[model samples]
Target: MTSSAFTESSLTGIPVKRGKVRDVYDFGDRLLFVATDRISAFDWILAPGIPDKGRVLTQISRFWFERFTTISNHLLSMDPADLPLPADTDLEALRGRCMVVRKTEVVPFECVVRGYLSGSGWKDYQATGAVCGIDLPAGLKQSDQLPEPLFTPATKAESGHDENVSFEVMSQAIGQELADSLREKSVQIYQQGSEYARERGIILADTKFEFGLLDGTPILIDEVLTPDSSRFWPAETYQPGGAQPSLDKQFVRDWLETTDWDKNSTPPVLPDQIVEKTREKYFEAYKMLTGEECTW
Candidate 1:
């Protein structure tokens, strides 16, 4: 891992908004998105960013955004030089890690699609035989493939964890028509992505997507189907009876579980070995899905 990692970005002539991993710079007409190498587990941003993680994430998202043209998205271009950045900005530093995207009125919900019973969905099923008020078959094991992919939406929170809500609640908040459209589009995107991943010996267990309206037209926004937003399990090693082996942030999550730190409060700094292993897993996932090595 390199000693240099981009945790935040500052550019002239743009207003900035920092998230858990991405840095957004508003340019009045468009937005500049920079995927930093910062990794967050349990909603806490950890120290010592993962090397080349930003480039890997940017390329992976670009791959999916271009491939899934059946749905509209906010991506304009990945090249920083092509964008209207200020003359003083560092183009080389932003290359491969930045995106110039169309700005839109972002919807205030997290459009989630689950192809398998895992994570919170599994817990919800075990407790009430339903996930987000959608009933599931009895006796479904962890990591088991569901009968069909489900559209489970949750409220987008600025801090802490996002709370899962019923579709009816989502509809009431965002209007039934827009909510329905988001659900349909989310399921379609997940199905297409999952089918492609299965052929590559990876399982797209579940993923969350964000949407925005451009002149009243809903287009996919934010990071789509990255390791931070989805679970990627190895198909050959998949066993529904237990937690499946993954090529995503599950590596980091599993390691964090072993630490003595409580889920609340400040997170402990990760060891060097854990950081290297996590970086390897992220790169492996990009290569496995796209069949292309990350040059950075």
Candidate 2:
């Protein structure tokens, strides 16, 4: 299949917000979320996007949202035909890449759950034998599985890196009742996803979730369990002492690290080889988890 990329999207209605990869349109009681093919790394949206990435991410989230019936979510439908699209809208372009969902006041924290020692959690553990103020056992190596998944929250920053914050801090900022609820739900969702992925020969190391409130009820919002929001490693080659091969954006990050360009500047356009490989990784993760090929 030929690859197609959408760096940005323009709809008839004014966009309420534009994230690194999604363009959200307000529809009074609901929202229209369009997942573009735009890719981001080091907190910067790169020049070129991986092809069919939006469809892969959208479909994967749809698969999880349908299965997570134990909790409430913002998803209404993935079919563009169900959305209140503007007249003359390109339905074909939006198919499988857009969602119609209930609107809510989004929480200000990034609800993260870590099942393994890697990424920032690994760095924090190496520095203080703890992650997000929660102490762990001594001598845990990189990518080592934690005794159990930990709910480590972070402040949701609009720009720059998200700083890890303790549960106490989170409770103070969002109230003890709400903080406790978010933590419990985040961990539960992560556990469910990890088990499902493990059975499919993939390791869902960790994932971050975003939540919002609708009439004082917490609901899962944004993308869920997509490669862009989680670290997925192949179970066949799982090794704990070092960085494991991944089925996520680690490929792009590894290539970026080899360049002389500092992360602060505008990211360079990805070469064709890198873009294709990244697309394949995203598609592979979706296929492995969903047991179906991407329609796009």
Count residue pairs with overlapping backbones in model 1. 0
Candidate 1 TM-score, true structure as reference = 0.97
State the lDDT of candidate 2 residue by residue for 142-217, as single tens digits.
9999999999999998767888888999999999999999999999999999999999999999999999999999
- Clash pairs, model 1 backbone: none
lDDT for each candidate structure: 0.89, 0.90
In model 1, where is the ten-residue run with the lowest total lDDT? 1-10
User: Which stretches of candidate 2 lie above 4 Å from their native place?
Assistant: none
Instruction: Tell me the lDDT of candidate 1.
Output: 0.89
**Residue 7's lDDT in candidate 2:** 64
